[model samples]
Target: MAELSPTAGESNYSQDIQVDEKLVPKKGLSLCSTRYGIALIIHVCNFIAAAQSTVINITMVAMVNTTDHQFQFNGSTEQLPGGPNNAPDSLPAEAPTYDWSPQIQGIIFASAAYGMTLTMALSGYLAGRVGTKRVVGVSLFASSLLIIFSPLAAELGLISLIATRMVQGLVQGSIFGGQNALWERWGPPHERSRLCTIALSGMLLGTFTITLVGGLISQTLGWPFAFYIFGGIGCVYCPFWFILIYDDPVSHPWINVTEKEYIISSLAQQIHNGLLSALPFIIAWVIGILGGYLADFLLTKNVRLVTVRKIATFLGNFPSSALLVALPYLPPSYITTMTFLTLSCGLSPLCQSGIYINALDLAPRYSSFLMGTTRGLANIAALLAPTVSGFLLNQDSEFGWRNVFLLLFAINLSGLIFYLICGDAVVQDWAKGRKLTRL
Candidate 1:
């Protein structure tokens, strides 16, 4: 090391210090560190967030499938033990589901998407200043309350129910707003894929768990219980989130120098938009183990991270969409069509690893905001896609479905081209900020 001295240099006054002398040797990576503890909690948080969103898929079935269960509360119908929060084993045989039309059902299905689109942009901006913990926690808690009240809204009338769902959508839409920042604070550069994947997969896991558990609860206790139970879980999780987690390594009380330094040093280097975050679970639900393994395998092979991600995006978008475009024109063969559909829809590992985790690659500091923008955009798609599909299918013919798939194909192709051309992996200039240093 060269020391600065008045006589050594006329203008310079700096000393050269060996970096290694000031650094501690890296410890072995562990699965059960404080960072991971945070990840586990976040995973559950995501699970709650996702379950509330997806449980709707299951609960709606009991409401609509029986057609007879009009939910009249005619005194003859028994409300569950917990009141509106629980549904009976079965609706009375002659009950009708409020004489709801398919169009109304479609509108209800898309309400959350609209609400989500409205808030995602705002949420991202909030996360940057207020911190991820507060934004996500409050958003989730609020969304849970809305879910609990969903059945109550249903009881009032169709318009009331739509209003309730829109609020729920807006609430839940903000839940993902801070996820990218949260990960940057917690994730070490090298371990981001594993840590982020595991944490984010909670939503996917929630979706899966709901399919299994929601059915049993809706079948045995009643459909309202699904919303109640899911909402309650989120409310319960809020305390733990506030108590155990902080914005960054420096603020976390339980972390040690070894881990803190490691995390800080690593992050010092480094969404779904909302739908993107939800994609891994989609792939996992559809493709299962093989897709995940394929993603990890490529990473292990020393492939450039950007190339790996690009490949994943290409795989996810092109073939599947192309298949959808061709399906309507194909010969009448169920096995062939089914095969095409399964591969196209089910296998999406590229999305799981590529677009889903692209936040870290772009700008780690602004990731939350960036993620929010993407999520907002994605919700716009969510809102529009269904409407478009419905419009195309209005004719109730193969031709209508064909048009729907064709539109999707065009959209997918455009996204693929844009991503290929504009997507990147290098850490961007915006992320080189002091604000990100802490979290």
Candidate 2:
């Protein structure tokens, strides 16, 4: 095997190295070659799934009004004569008719997170056995089914909705895990940073799309139809996934010989080590927890509406108008709460990608494992966020949001410290001091 070595005077090394034509591996589609395209598709899928998740938060009021027997709005038990409220008017309508407890709502919101916490821990093991493509495919398929069933659960009861959400959460976790693994396997070292940015950015897009679409759908066709739309979109993407993706470079026919050589040579140095060594899982945990709380804090505090509006305007007038239309329909308290939540949630993925990309930089071979570990730890944070927030909110509803924000900020600052201290140097000097090393 020919090994690369730095030399003082050698130029045109590519021409000097002679090998049997048969021995030189032919160029083929590799992680480096196909990463951008595959990652793009994965991002699209993630966005659809994420949108479904966030959209429901906005539609909670509409959903309860339409489906639940015990739900009431504005202190009046009187049923609307027509519209989405199909429940019988004769049903006993009393004061405190709908039991919309924060605990119950927390359970509904937290179900997916609980599943994510569990699945992310085990996803690496599962992906090792089934391959990343299968893992992602199966998870997305199951999630699509669960999302389709979510509205049905709403029709049944809050418990049923929670159950479906939990299932969906598990599937979502698996998708995230598998996607990360796939990227590590396929992405080139040079492109890892940009690829991570693009892949993670999808979460924001997904959140925005879901919130905007959910608001529109809930306003027009009612809340259940929102799930249908998201689910349908997910299903449509599955076939494309199946057709376009391959598990490894050897499996892809479209890759060229030069690209394959580049990928193998680039990754050859790092593939033999253990998978989790380079990951900053602890940092990820802190970031995830703080990010979740920050989002909740923003949702509850509403301090950045002007900034948010400017952002929305820069993006487009349609999205800004959509937010305005949706805000009035929501309870005044929730409007600001959800807005901040959206921004915070959107920001978390970027933070996560930044941390995970560092792991790849530190150990390219073990990138998948590091990503999985970090993701698992982060999911735990996601699971705990709602519960902690609930506890604080219960103690003092007025000031609890600020407390959460403060806590999140402190935690994130700590993570930033770790990042500064531990991030890998861009170029590693593996050989130094020895006679051969000096060469």
Candidate with maximal lDDT: 1
Per residue, candidate 2 scores C-alpha lDDT tens digits across 63-142 of 44332322231233444443333432433232012234433554566567656745664565567556778888888878
Candidate 2 colliding pairs: 27-256, 27-257, 28-255, 29-255, 31-186, 70-98, 299-337
Cα lDDT for residue 399, candidate 2: 48
lDDT of 1: 0.62
Return the TM-score for candidate 2, rounded to 2 decimals. 0.53
In model 1, the runs with Cα more than 4 Å from the true position are: 1-29, 65-89, 92-96, 269-439
**In candidate 2, which residue ranges exceed 4 Å CA deviation?**
1-33, 66-99, 272-411, 414-439
**What does candidate 1 score on TM?**
0.53
User: Clash number for every model?
Assistant: 10, 7
User: How accurate locally, in lDDT, is each candidate?
Assistant: 0.62, 0.52
